[model samples]
Target chain A: MSTVTKVSSRYERDKELFLRYAAIIESSDDAIVGKTLEGIITDWNPGAQRVFGYSPDEVIGKSVLILFPPERMEEEMDILGRVAKGERVENYETVRVRKDGKRIDMSVTVSPIRDSSGRIVGASKIARDITESKLLHASVLEAERHFRETLDHMLEGCQIIGFDFRYLYINDAAATHGRHSKKALLGRKMMEAYPGIEETEMFAFLRKCMENRIAQRLENRFDYGDGTFSWFNLSMEPVPEGTFILSVDITNEKKLQVELEKHRDHLQEIVNERTAQLQEANRELESFSYSVSHDLRAPLRHINGFVELLQKKLPSSIDKECLRYLHVISSASSEMGHLIDKLLDFSRVNRASINKSDVDVGSLVRQVIASLAEEAPGRSVDWQVEKLPDVYGDQAMLRQVFINLLSNALKYTGTRTTAKIKVRSISGKGEDIFVVEDNGVGFDMRYVSKLFGVFQRLHSNDEFEGTGIGLANVRRIIERHGGRTWAEGKVNEGASFYFSIPRFIEQRG
Target chain B: MITRLGRILLADDSRNDVELMLLALGHFNLANEVDVVRDGAEAVDYLYRGGKYAERGGQNPALMLLDLKMPKVNGIEVLRTVKNDPLLQTIPVVVLTSSREESDMVSSYELGANAFVVKPVDFHEFIESVKNLGFFWAIVNEPPPVSRNGGEQLEG
Candidate 1:
């Protein structure tokens, strides 16, 4: 009961283990098969029938070459050779054919099967389908290519910096902005690529953004070793790996702002210089007028005074010719005196301070006319006065203007039996124009340009008794009030003098 | 009829002007009582009894006719000095000048000048104005009595 019974029991246990192994192989998801060295199928499992789309009876005697594509038949021979030599092939990926004539990707392992005599007779092969994994790997490669293309096409300069302050990735724009190629910049330190970026505010900002895990924006000027400078608007963001940077050029805008500021300062300097020169000229004119008023009149008075004493002391002793000569001297001296006085008056108008108020021009003219009528009671003059507008100006200066113009009309029209003087006003663009029309012995229009010039005369002393300063004074006073004056006349018709004053616009709250 | 008063002082730089003024005063028979000084300094000296007139004994003149543009001291300076002095403040001073400048007139009045007159260019008007000035100051306008003690003398 010992030796014979123990040997029988051990043999039965070994047979049971072989049946369990076969059961596991048949139910596995992998295709398990046994083939001979000549590549003929000897045994097939349920997984092999499921994968090849063929049942066990149909493929039991078929060659293993039936499972290979036409171009891969040589691969099977090579695999069978290795298996026959007792060399195991593991996970050798290749193509295979299914029952439906479609191609599939597969990974296979082949091992030599041995008999009890220790001689290799066939190969046991296991294959796994890998089509889904191959498809996923191909799609991942395509996505990487798309991302690289998008970075190359960007407008802003972009760069990725490593924690070691070296370049990890740089786009096309970033390479151009840095004045370097991507091949030269990648894996290179910022100082190595730009040579002096460590000294620049841009490098400092990037370092700060990386260290503090914050975002920052700044402007910096870079000097390229060739004596040229460029300004950039830099923005840096802290990324998980390192720092991301974007840069934009702003050199032209900075240059334009500096140019505009220079022009403004230059214009202000020119204005100050011109104002100083004008003030100097005005001071000289004032001194000249003061001297003319004081010194010039003294000699004229002495000449007239001595002549009068001679006439009074020797009235009977003087001959008619001598007396006439003396009279000429006296008259000429008096005329010179009058001329001097008028000249001083004209200059005073230029230097006097202007005091402005609402002035009644119509009533002032009426008063002047009444005085003229009283002075020339013998002559009958027709006066036509219009309703005049009140203007803002120096009242005394305006009165002087009216007096001069009206007196000129009265003087020129002395020859007329019925002299007509018309004073009227008309509204003009941004101003009020007053015209004094006289129907009298009018002046020749040929000398109209000389009317407002100082000491310029339109008529001889015999024709009109005047020192030729009234119109000049009238022009000066009007000009000081920000107005203009002009005269129009014919040889014998009438003369009309026109003057315009700027209209005042009142400020309202 | 012109009544005689205290001495009249006239200050002028021009010889011809002084001669004419004297001739005009001669017509009023008051020329002897008038004193003529060549410059403003002489006028001041005559009034203060200093310089050349220190030896002479007199009171302040009843009227002083001052010309503005004179050498050594100007009429404005002379007027300022005389008006500030207590003994000479009561003396009437007239600015008679050829300058018709408004600033000169205003300054003369501001300096306590009793009258401002522009000398006429015509000889007849000059003579007539001088005659009227002589008669009015020497006869029509009464002057304060002589202040021997340099004291204030108010006149009616």
Candidate 2:
């Protein structure tokens, strides 16, 4: 009887311990409940109520289908059948409806309950609320999707390589640059995937980045496999255990640089050709000058020598009339010598090199007039020179042009009573056109064509003491200044000589 | 001392210039005398009393005026020959040529010629230059005593 009483007390203590464990499971956050194998809800704890939005009163004796979503009813029945067959389902997470009709994520553990006779009578299920964990996972997946979309749409190619140089991820831009699909690129080694780029600057830069464990950038060219080359500015950044690269096409910039270099080479070639031509012309001019100095002087000396001889050797018995005639011959020959010298100087102007600078044309013209007036002091000549425009040209050359024109006007008009000479400027066709007009023995219109030719004189030698080289020199000077010269005249009337200079010629020279 | 009316030798290539020079020299009869040679070779032969000039020469002329441009031998060679010969060096040689170039004048003077005269173009000027040349060289000037080989060998 005492043994029976002790066993009863031990049984009471064990029963009390089991009741305490049951209360702990009920009051804990985890949903602990017991159910019949026939798919009925036999018990519901507070955690179960919280997970399924149902109380024990509302859930007990009802089918467990009340806690499942409508779409998951079949799956719930299959699960219940499996539990009745003595199968325990552990950590079965599924969607359950709350009391507010909201779908919540729950993990369920269903185990078969057995009596001391070893027969399964019912099942106990532990349900835990896992909605927070599920929300975190969904948010992470959304973020990854957004990142992939952004990278794929970028203009620059983006690539991610593993520590072993295998492609972990590549955006659409990178796939297009490699001329392949993203699926083909994944899990492929960089060298095997893009064999051409393996030994290129791109590979070298990537290797450097890997070695240094820092970011690196390089500009290099790549063959596009279509007979064309593309330039790229590649930036490689070393990430933890991997490298990320961005590439921008710089082919257009490289093309522009090549074009500029070609242009420079072409310009240099032109300059070199022009310089050679100028040097050749200068050599010819020096020889020409040498010929002029040596050859032309010989004839003048002969003319002077013969004249002097004739004057000295004439017999005293010769007629006074004949002696006077001999004197005329000697004077004419001297005059001819002077003319030849002037002609030589005129031809030399062609060999002159132009040097452009600011020139005071007004003062130069006044000086010419003053000098001419002094030369012909006896003649009453009115010199009217207008305010001249400041010009940019070879000062000595421009002075020569004006001097020739003025002197010609003065010389031709010597016969006129109170000879009137005028120097003036007028605007014409974006040029400064200067005119030297004279009221004197004018040239015929027919003879105007021959005016600027070497030794082409319109008037007879008796009428003028000129070598006829003046106008020709004037023409050459104006032409060398990038200008033109012309004359208008009628016999016995006045003559006007005009010349113009282009504005750009000054700046260009 | 021998008088100043001794002969003057003028070597020229041009007929016109020789004619003119003779007319100028005609005025000076007593104090100065003029003799003309056609070319540089003839001038040298006449100075050495050889060739056509060997027969009737009495004495060497007082002075020799030589023209530059000529056929056969040119001016510098003549001047070089005259200056190199010790016998002819004492006889003053004047270069009277139409070449008025400074280089010609400098070279002639440097080659031991006494004077270089550029003939003038006008006839009156030529006469004046010739008159002055005769007056200065014949009347006013004095010549060094003739060398043994320089003066003419008077045959008589």
Candidate 3:
């Protein structure tokens, strides 16, 4: 309890604390060293030996410059200059060299060591190897570059906006699609850059997505004030800061859709107008058929009837000339009547409702040939009929077609002593083409165009007695069944009539 | 040699058609029993014993040859009236006309017409058809007895 005894005990306690601090520094994982203001190594701990690869004896009197790499030698001086001025250099990251001559990244802290008199003597430095953290930082910077490059090369327009509606980032596509430069858009308000975008539906959708933290998609047309417009499909999603947007150009597709709709409307209008006109024409044709069947035939019957009465009343009193005149009148009236009947048949082919069924073409042709044979009893005609395929059409209309064609064949072949008619069928494009060829007095090829015209006759009545409406009737009937009729002939050689009908495919239920 | 069974009623609007029909009937000496009316109204009156022949008729005609196209009423209307009447329905109604329209033929059949014949444009064919019709209706086919009290009469 004396004053001197107390001071000596305090001194012993201070030495005990210093030894404990020394033990702690020696067991640390970091390097701890004591050096002088002149940059000489004074003390080195076990951690310093482990990090610098040097033992305490090897580095106790060496200059600290031995641990500095040649390129970082000035770093030691700069650190020492600050430490000698009683300033602590904290986290002075630089490169250093090991005893084995390998270099490593290090983070160092240097503090001015003080004596018992409070005067700076040397410095105590702590260092840590930071090579892993340095490599991690470099990799992080490389990934950021890759992400920016990927955004720049995307085809779809991408843009990132801040909460203040300013463009934080705009990809290359977004800048080009918006018809503006990236330099002009970045860090600029979106409304200021596009001017009219604030009033657009795309802007509204983007704002809604941002406010509600949701995603939205919209299509809008941007009119450029010049006569040009562009359509865009915009997809917007709420991000952390504001909204992220992706835009795709759909101008061409939208234009094509609009044009197709317009064409469809135009076609519908044309079909309606054509149907109305066809209905009107059918009404007129019906009235014409009615008049021809009744009023016209009545007059002709009266003419023939009166002539017959005149002949019956005064057969013996009538002179030969008068009788001959009466015969002409009667024959002419009968001819007119025949013409009217054939005309009505032709018109009926147009007006009648087509009842479709499978028709046997071969049997129909045979029946027609037999009727023609009965009409021309004395003619020696050789008929060659092929095995015809069944067709789907109106049976009666097809029968009429065959009747007219066969009758024409029999009549034209009257000049030949042995008339030969060949009936055959060949398959055509999507149809069956039936040919009726005859070795007859063929018509001139110049008048072939008029063959299917009503009242158009090639030969005079004296040569071949006909009303000249048979082929016309044949054409009308075939046309009603969605078929076509045509002829091929040469003068005095032979003639062939050809008609085509669509092939029928069986329908499945 | 033609039997005078019953009166034949001929309804035609065309004068020439009527004259021809009369001549055709005269060929068989059956014209005396035949009575001609100008239009369908007269035909209806003659059958009903109204208008002109109310006092002159003995009984309803045995056969009526109705022309389709007439001025006041058509052949179809006259056929409809006669076929619906129980008293007059026994008479055989034949439609003879210039029209060969399918609608006319279908309507005639639907209205219970006994026969439909188109007048031929050929005079000889017309005469032959008329002769056959007159001979068959007047001489071959039996006629119903006269209805005297506007009631259906059982035929003997």
Candidate topping lDDT? 3
TM-score of 1: 0.65
Alpha carbon deviation, residue A313, candidate 1 (Å): 3.3
Residues A40-92, candidate 3, lDDT per residue (tens digit)? 99999898899889999999988999998888788878888888789999998
Write out the backbone clash pairs for model 3.
Answer: none
Instruction: Give the runs in model 2 whose Cα sits over 4 Å from its true position.
Output: A1-158, A161-216, A221-232, A238-242, A248-267, A303-350, A353-358, A425-435, A441-468, A478-509, B1-156
* Local distance difference test, each candidate: 0.85, 0.79, 0.87
How does each model score on TM-score?
0.65, 0.52, 0.68
Provide the DockQ value for model 3. Answer: 0.66
User: Candidate 1's residue-wise lDDT over A1-509, tens digit each?
Assistant: 88879999999899999889988997898898899888889988888877788788988878988888999889988998888889999999988898888888888999999999989999999988887787888789888888878877687778889888999989988787777899999999988877877887778888899889899999888777778887788888888779988877777888987888898889888988898888988878776776676677778778888888788888596689999998999989988878888888888887789988888888988998998889988888999999999898988999899889988898888889999999999999989999999987788888899999999997888888888788898999999989999989987798999999998878111
Extract clashing residue pairs from model 2: A53-A99, A304-B121, A307-B121, A308-B121, A308-B122, A311-B123, A312-B123, B60-B152
Weakest 10 consecutive residues of candidate 3 chain B by summed lDDT: B147-156
Q: TM-score, chain A, per candidate?
A: 0.61, 0.59, 0.64
Give per-residue lDDT, candidate 3, residue B57.
41
